[model samples]
Target: MRAAVFDRFGPPDVLHVVHIPDPQPGPGEVRVRVLAAGVQPFDVGVRQGNMPWAKVEFPQTIGQEYAGVVDALGEGVRDLAVGDPVLGSTMLNGNAELLCVAAANVVRKPHNLDFPTAAALVAASQTASGALLELGVGEGDVLLVHAAAGSVGTVATQLARLAGATVIGSASFDNHSRVRRQGALPVPYGEELIAAVRDTGLQPTAALDGAGAEAIAQSVALGISPDRIGTIVDDKAAAEHGVRVVRAGRDPERLARVIALAAEGKVLMPVQAFPLSEVVEAHRAVESRHSHGKVVLIIEP
Candidate 1:
């Protein structure tokens, strides 16, 4: 099996694919022949050695989410079978040709969802859905999403709209059209952000920040109560402003629900793909912070 691994944390050049021993399913786990893997900011953090609590070995594997076909099943795995198409969250080993993960954690992929798109939804879906749930966003509310063109914010905007909230999304002028297409009114970010949102004629009842510290401050300027402001990106700013840091952790159920919506064409995630061998370039794209959509590694391509 071949997998992307890094011996030392530094730049994108630190990542490279190399042959490693194939892993077999252990009890309650299944081995998946990975078709695609989502590249996340978390993966970038892991690669740069920024996550102090992430357990890292010298030659460490660094992906968190993947979609693939099941090749083998561990003992007691009754709900899924060999050859099943599944997508799910994994820990530090998803960017590989084959990965073993707990069968309980994997979600069955709908036939309508391609591997890359399915993989793309895994983390962002979970994060966005969880954040919305934590924020209690719903009918009669106006939700403000910072960095709305991003993976998490894209999902967040759509899901909030589905839940009956009016959405105002902040992005650069270039991405405003994309943001509006995601069912939100688009507002340009930076110093003029508050005025931009104000011009939309909607008072933000709650805010979700996917951008950094500046987003938090701008949301506060909109007169949204600190309790109603949730941030997944800037915890330090969240703490300073007395805003909630919504740790929208991984949840397979949340991911599955969003996946179902995607399969039905109710939710969409655009993908920018790189073949597995070009893992370094993929990492660099995510690091550049200008990727147009979810960046994914097409493992089998």
Candidate 2:
């Protein structure tokens, strides 16, 4: 199997595709023939050696989410079988031709969702859904989503709207139209953010910050209570502001629900894709922090 691996932590160029021995599924596990994998900001941090708690070894593979077909099943795995299309979260080995994961962690992919699209939803779906649940965003509330153009923010905004909350999304002028399309009243970010939300005549009752740059402070300025404000980014600012830092851990059930919504066209995620050979470029796109959508690696086609 060919996998993207890095010998050292540095820049995108450090990632290279190389052949490695195929891995076999253990008991209760299934081996997937990877079709697509999502590249995230967390991967960039891993590549740059920014995450202190993450253990890295030489020639390490890095990726978190993938969509693929089941190629093999290990002992005790019964609910899924060979050739079943599935998507799920993994630790650090998604950017490969094949991967083995626990069957319980995999979600069946809907026929309407393509491989890349299914892969794209893995992380953002879980994160956004968990954040909204934790913040108790619901009817008659206005939800402010920072970095509304981002993957997590995009899903968060749409989900909040579906929950009957008016959404105010913060993004640059370039992404205002896109944010608005996601059911958010688009507002410009930075120092003018609070005023922009006020201009929209929406009072934010809950806030989800995907963008780290003073978003918690801005949410506070908008009169949102600290307990109602949550951040997935900038834990430091979250602590300083006494706001909640939402971990939004991965959950297969939550991911599956969002996937079902995506299949029904209630939620959408744009994918910027690159071939597996161009994994370096994929990493670069994610690191740029300006990609219009989720960045993914096309591993099969």
Candidate 3:
């Protein structure tokens, strides 16, 4: 099998494509023939050693989420079968031709979704959905999504709207129209952001900080309930600021909902694809912090 392998991680340039041994499934697990892999901010952070809190082994294969077919199933796995289309998350090791995943971690891909969209949903979309659930957002509420044009923000805005919330999204002027297209009232992110949202007379009842920017802290200062604020960025100051976080190892139910929404075309994933051999470029694109969508790797034809 060929994979993007890195020894002593430093930057995206450290990643190289090379032949590696094929992984096998264990009991209650399945081996997926990877079709598409989602590149997340965590993937880049793990590769560049920015997440010192997370200990990763050397020669790591970095990827967080993927979509593929179950080529083989381990003993005790009965709900799935050979050739089942699935999307899932792994603590590591998704950026390859095959990955062994616990049966519980994998879900059948929505019948109407393609592999790329399925792959993109697990990480970003799920986080967005889970955040909205945590904040208790619903119909008639005003929800504000920071960096709403990004991968998670885009899905979150749509999900909020679908849940009947009035949604406001902050992005650069360049992406305002795109956010509006997703059913969010677009507000330009910067000094004028708060006022722009205020002009609409929508007092935000909840907030999701996908931006990881200083502006997020400022938003919290505007008097929305701290319990209603959550961030995917895992900023250390969240607790002190009375904000919440969506961390690793959450229950998979929120993710499952996001997958269903994608299949139903109620949610969207803007994604850019690169061949598996170009994993480094994909990482660079993610690290650039200007990607308008999720960056993904096409691992199989």
Candidate 4:
């Protein structure tokens, strides 16, 4: 099996592909022949040695989401078969030719959703849905999403719209049109954001911050209550502003719901894909914060 691994944490260039023994499934686990994988900011942080709490060792494989076909099953698993198309969350091994995850944690991929698209939805769907649920965003509420053009933000914008909320998304002017297509009234991000949002004439009742920096503080300046402002990107700022720091934990059920919506074309995340041989470039794209949507590696094709 060929996997992306980093012997030591540093820049994106540290990531390299190498052949290793194929991983075997344990009891209740299933081995997947990975077709695509999603790269996240979490992966970048882990690679930069910023996440001390994450377990890491020399030559650690790095990726958190995968979509592929099942090839083998382990003991005590009877719910899925060898040909099942699955997508779900994994840790440190998704950027490989194969990975083993608990069968109980896998979400069946819809036939209409291709591998790259399914892989793109894995983390962002869970995070965005969890944040919206925690924030109580719905009808009659005008919601502001920071980094609205980003993976998590894009999902958040679309999901919030589906829940009957009017969404205002913050992004670079270059992405304004893309954000608008996702059902948000797009506004430029950063120092001028508050003014831009104000010009839209919609008062935000809640805010979801996927872009750190001054998002929480700016949300405060916009007259939104601290209780209704949630952030998945900035915890320290959330604490400083006395707002909610959303912990978008992994929940297979939550991911499944979003996947179902995606299958019906109700939600979508654009994929910026690179082949497995360019794992380094994939990391660079996610780290740059300029990728059009979700950054993914096409591991098999």
Over 4 Å off, model 4: none
Stretches of candidate 3 off by over 4 Å are none
For model 3, residues 20-65, the per-residue Cα lDDT tens digits are: 8999899999999999999988888888888898768877777889
Ranking of all candidate structures by their lDDT, best first: 4, 2, 1, 3
TM-score of 1: 0.99
Worst 10 residues of 1 by lDDT: 292-301
TM-score for each model = 0.99, 0.99, 0.95, 0.99
In order, what lDDT does every prediction score? 0.94, 0.94, 0.84, 0.94
Which runs in model 2 stand beyond 4 Å of their true positions?
none
Task: Return whichever of 3 and 4 wins on TM-score.
Answer: 4
Clashes of 4: 0
List model 1 lDDT by residue over 1-301, tens digit each.
9999999999999999999999989999999999999999999999999999999998998899899999999998999999999999999999999999999999999999999999999999999999999999999999999999999999999999999999999898999889989999998889999888889888999999999789999889889999999999898999899999999888899999999999999999999999999999999999998998999999874
Once superposed on the true structure, which residue ranges of model 1 sit more than 4 Å away at CA? Answer: none
Positional deviation of 234 in candidate 2, in angstroms?
0.6
The sequence of per-residue lDDT tens digits that candidate 4 reaches over residues 1-301 is 9999999989999999999999999999999999999999999999999999999989899999999999999999999999999999999889999999999999999999999999999999999999999999999899999999999999999999999999999999999999999999999888999999999989999999998869889999999999999999888998899999999799999999999999999998899999999999999999999997899999873
TM-score of 4: 0.99
